[model samples]
Target: MDIETWMRGYETAWRSNDGDDIGTLFTDDAEYFTEPWTPPWRGRDEIVRRWVERADAPGDWTFSWHVVGVDAGTATAFVQGETCYAELATTYSNLWVIRFADGGRAASFTEWWMDQAHASDGDGDGEELG
Candidate 1:
């Protein structure tokens, strides 16, 4: 699949809320950089473990259009989303840098965010870290 198509599949998978579907998107050795100093998480198993433990109601999370930029076999895109996870519902945005493998699994996915790329929940505030 093309970059756009692959990205669309990921967005669809997020909406589907099927753990398997989301889990299956990553390569076995996928490396995920959630944030600076967070230490990149290696292996899809670890990544999915954290995701499952962190997510609240599945439907509470979703991404808008992903504008992809293609360069060779790598792709970059910005994702806008809103999510309510357990105790927090907030507007968020991020840049996802991805590298596609030979068979199309995500060899790497680095999410670049600004303060979680979060805005207020509209009803209230995003929790302050300090």
Candidate 2:
């Protein structure tokens, strides 16, 4: 499958913030890591659940790809994004390690977004901790 196509699907799904759509982009065993202060999820089921929970927002969650490095079956994509969490506004620079599935209809991916403390402090007083 083409990397561009894969990325398009991923990006579209992300913007939708619809877990049903986002979860469909990956294989059943694919894991998604979305931690600002907790353990990462390790499967599509978990990914969808958490994503749906996040979809309960005041405003839409948006993401923009900044840069990407791809080779063979793996890709590293960095993106800048923001989300409205109830009342607090949050922004982040997130990274993803994508491993395309071989002979499967889905791809394996892992997401690593910036820590909340780091985002709040902005290279200043607070200690950066993941």
Candidate 3:
């Protein structure tokens, strides 16, 4: 599967938070790691369940991403992204490592994210108070 198309589907699934939509992104035995060190949500069923449990409300966040690199031989792609949470006035920088299966579905996915520090002035501008 094309990496860009898969990423777009991921964004769609993120916004919708629908079980079916989320299910389509992974294989039956997919492993999803929310953080590099944390335990993964194994299998599509678990991933769907856990995802819905922590589902983000629609319109509450905006995300932008770009593919950083790809190893076609390994079926892996590296992605960088930024997520802005409107209500919290916070943003996070994310790096995702995705390994795709034979088809478009992901066989394994891992994410590393860090919250961007902002000034305390409550301006929501995402600027550091240097």
Candidate 4:
């Protein structure tokens, strides 16, 4: 699967949090790492379970991403994304490394995320700047 198409599907899965939609993105033996250092959710079943457990509510957030690089030989793609949580007034930057198996399903996926510091007015109180 092409990076763009796969990413679109991922966005759909993220919004829907449907097990079947999530399952379509990964291989049977796929591994998903929520953070670089954390142990991955191994296999499609576990991945689906974990994803649903931590699913983001629809309309609470918005995300945009772009492919940074791709290595065709290894079927790997690097992507960068930004997520804004409208209700929480928070934003996060994300980096994902994906290794695609045959048929375009991800064999392995790892993500690194950093919360963006909210802009504050001069006041010491934690009020976010609009």
- Sorted by TM-score (best first), the order is 4, 3, 1, 2
Candidate 3 on 13-126: residue-level lDDT in tens? 989999999999999999999998999999999999999999999999999999899999999999999999989999999999999999889999999988877434557875
TM-score of 2: 0.61
List model 1 lDDT by residue over 19-120, tens digit each: 676667788898878874578878888877776666546466555654555566344344443333423555555667777777667878777655443444
Q: lDDT tens string, model 4, 8-89? A: 9999999999999999999999999999898999999999999999999988999999999999999999999999998898
- Where's the lowest-lDDT run of ten residues in candidate 3? 118-127
Instruction: Specify the poorest-scoring 10-residue window by lDDT in model 2.
Output: 77-86
Clashing pairs in 2: none
Ranking by lDDT: 4, 3, 1, 2
- TM per prediction: 0.67, 0.61, 0.89, 0.89
Q: Which ten residues in a row are the worst by lDDT in model 1?
A: 78-87
lDDT per residue as tens, model 2, 1-130: 4555666776666667777677767777776655534566667888788776766442455555644665653433334443333334665566666666764325556667764546543466665545
Task: Point out where model 4 deviates above 4 Å.
Answer: 118-130
The lDDT leader among the candidates is 4
Candidate 2 regions exceeding 4 Å error are 36-39, 56-59, 73-89, 103-107, 115-130
Which sections of candidate 3 miss by over 4 Å?
A: 118-130
